[model samples]
Target: MYAIVEMAGQQFKVAKDQKVYVHRLQTEEGKKVTFDNVLLLDDGKNITVGAPAIDGAAVEAKVVKHLRGDKVIVFKKKRRKGYKKKNGHRQSLTEIVIESIVAKGAKKAAPAKAEKPKAAPKAKAEAKPAVEKEAPAKKAPAKAKVKADDLKKIEGIGPKIAETLVAGGIATFADLAKAKPEKLSEIIADVRGNHVTDTWPEQAKLAAEGKWDELKKWQDELDGGKA
Candidate 1:
């Protein structure tokens, strides 16, 4: 099971035992935290999408550690002004291990109840009829196929990331087209830690604009280290 949860100002899609890093929270290390803003849940069989977020659905996580991100160098330069400034900054972050996911009001199977003693069976001799009723064969429900381009169809997904999403069952243009940036960000973060924003929404916008060739060209440039 997996759930899409919101923490700090960002959303995260997490599954059991998965570790996630996000903006630092006030909670201490090793403490348990519950994310109430559960936007979606997938139980392998069915996906429950939240309208603004599913009511009564929650994701439980344990704080693993509090740490700082790698130093980011900020360099500013002015042409002909001889003005140059260099600075470094590190962001505080929290590492969390996802626990169980629960959907509100989901029914649990009840344990077998005790039964009373059965009465003695009556002895009766009867001839069995040769006629038999045929039981109708049950048909299996059709499984939805995840498409390779569906992930790319989302508002902020790239080719490689789209491959991951498609393999993970997020196939279909409509499925990805309906996904929010925040939700897609969560999925991307889960896949490629900390680098989800580089080319997500932009790619999605291109798909939405029917600019498949342009999108592929841009992706090629990025892959070729041109950008």
Candidate 2:
């Protein structure tokens, strides 16, 4: 069984015996704390969701330790002005081990454990060792396949953006098309009043062009007339 718990203004999805670090709380080490704000609970086959929070649902945890985060150095300086300052800070933290997650009115769930796969039985008898063969000098690794005009098939990409990306040596559909999370923020800044980030245009471009396996989902849906 697992629980969705709220602690120090953060929500965590955790299971029994798992240790989590959160903003420090005023509980002593080895003390027990119960998080009553259970947002959701799951016991494999069934799930219970809270209305804001579940009444009488709670997760029990043992405070393992009170600790401090690594010190961070903060430095500020103004160019051409001889003004500079440095400061160091460390954040307080708490380590807690989830003990149990219980549904208020339901019986405890059976513990889930991972079973190891059994080993295959030994061969009936060891075969005589054959004279080693050089196996055709093992073929060389193949070069990565490249598609030069993959961007042309995507619906939303214009010739200008295609030229811009292709000029930057991005020739294949498998090339990174989606701007990274940080890069997306910069793109948002460049667009000013537009909310293009919500569209994830680059990812959509890759999906439409069939560069990733996830794109097959959309293709399948379209084929099924579900689009």
Candidate 3:
């Protein structure tokens, strides 16, 4: 029998006694772990597939060891901007051997969150005045339209970097201008390429101050978001 399972943000195919290497997990070495994210199972002649992930299905494995992968070089450069940056990184990994795949009686995985309860019905006698109700409804959509700014306007930020900044709650030009470059680098550590953030705050400051012509002038002189 063989099964396809997900673990530590990655997927793999495995069978009994088969070993695999994956991203490092929080579990210690020489310990047993069970993953309840079984996506598919095949037993010789029959097959089972999940709606998203099969319920009550699981895979058991034992952590054999922990190690780090080879170092990788990340380099970045911008044309005519005299900008160049390079760095190295290594990935942490774990080795595990599959012990078994269970199709039933496994702890059920909670995939979706429970829906919120509906608000209680309003009292009939309290029939609210229509004047008060009309204003709130009109204001709701106006507030919703005030969305985060296009943070990519800053030179050094690419799609991934802008997404990271948004996810970290730094979504506006004003907000980015107020942030420290050190904090920006720490938040964007997951981005693939090496980055220089020294000039990001200054660019954001220009944008926030509505100095569009000046900001564009400065950006044209920049390379790969570097000054």
lDDT of each residue in 31-112, candidate 1, tens digit only = 9999888888899998988777787788888999888788666567999999975444455578998888888744334558
> Candidate 2: RMSD over Cα atoms?
18.9
Give all candidates' CA lDDT scores. 0.66, 0.62, 0.80
State how far residue 121 of model 2 sits from its true place (Å). 92
State the TM-score for model 1: 0.46
Taking the tens digit of each residue's C-alpha lDDT, what string does model 2 give over 1-227?
Answer: 88888876579999999999976667899999989888888999988887778777888999999876675565679999998754444445689999999787433344589899886555522322221234335657889876676554443234554565566655555553554422332322322121222223455565646566766455443311112
Best candidate (score: TM-score): 3
In model 3, the clashing pairs are: none
lDDT of 3: 0.80
Q: What residue runs in model 1 are displaced by over 4 Å at the alpha carbon?
A: 105-227
| Number of the candidate with higher lDDT, 1 or 2 | 1
Clashes of each: 2, 0, 0
Candidate 2 TM-score over all chains jointly: 0.44
